[model samples]
Target: MNLLDENNRHPTAITDNSAYDGEPTWSPDGRWLAFASNRTGSGEIYITPLEGGVARQITHHPAWDENPSWSPDRDNPRIAFVSSRDGHFAVYVIDLAFVPGAGLPAERRVSPLEYTAFDPSWSADGRTLIFAASLRGHSEIYAIDIDAAPSADGYAMRPLTDGLIDRQQPAWWP
Candidate 1:
């Protein structure tokens, strides 16, 4: 991790290791950073204080877990990321509050199991997630209510944009 100063000069290296870290997202308060790294051989999510500290591993799965999106809600801190832990790529949430030597909190599958989902962006309220998913060979933008009960098909995802176009990342307009 590197921090670029106000003048865009030489970025001060926040991390000085050979671990391939990517997709860094700052917390709502800007006190910490959540990102994915291959330091442990496989992709895993990790959290580190922006002020300089040890990066703590958040996800402990053998499969690839990357693309972390920090929740906007600080009261119920969580991170939404894409993981292939369940056989295929899908959106999953990691509760930060419960991750101190307690293994991982219950895995919360945010995206539908039937689709290959990626790039999860949280709503302002942190109650919803918007991501790109490919189902039936078509890529589309989907918004899912994280707390809503699953439908008969096991997912309550609503499509926001649909087409044959290759849509990968969908972010909410500020």
Candidate 2:
């Protein structure tokens, strides 16, 4: 899919696939573009040069993986996303540099906090991660401090908004 610049003049394909590609998020450094594509038999996250080239699949799963967001600093090298490889859908995180070309060797499952977690949005500062988690039969927003890695003790997550209604898809404000 092509995305237009703010001036609505410059257009970019973001991906080369003629099949289906969308949800393109540029790398913080502006060198690579990350997006979701189904051209590889199943929907998975693919990264390509911002200038455009053969897209490389970043995820390999029989289940779908979508909503990929890059971290602010390349040094940290992290991509937050949602994957349904497990029986139920959940949130996952993978190291861009740590995972080999074969695709994410092993995705760190971050969901199933209360029920299931999906739609993760990384903080611009890159210290926290906010995502939607289904709890008590309803979806809610939750935030975790990535700076403090989750240990055997467990990471603390708090609801951004407390309510009984459903909430899905979360984006952080700069």
lDDT of 1: 0.88
Top-TM-score candidate index:
1
lDDT agreement with native, every candidate: 0.88, 0.78
**Per-residue alpha-carbon lDDT of candidate 2 for residues 1-174, written as tens digits (9 for 90 to 100):** 776798868877665557789887878888887888889778798888867578888787788888888878667777788887886677777777775665464457776544677888898887778998886788889888765767564655767988879998888877
Query: What is the per-residue lDDT of model 1 for residues 71-163, given as tens digits with 9 covering 90 to 100?
Result: 999898989999999899999988877755566665588787789999999999888999999988878999988878988888788999867
Error of 1 at 104 (Å): 2.8
Q: Which clashing pairs does model 1 show?
A: none
- Model 2 ranges with Cα > 4 A deviation: 5-10, 100-106, 151-155
Compute the lDDT of residue 153 as modeled in candidate 2.
Answer: 44
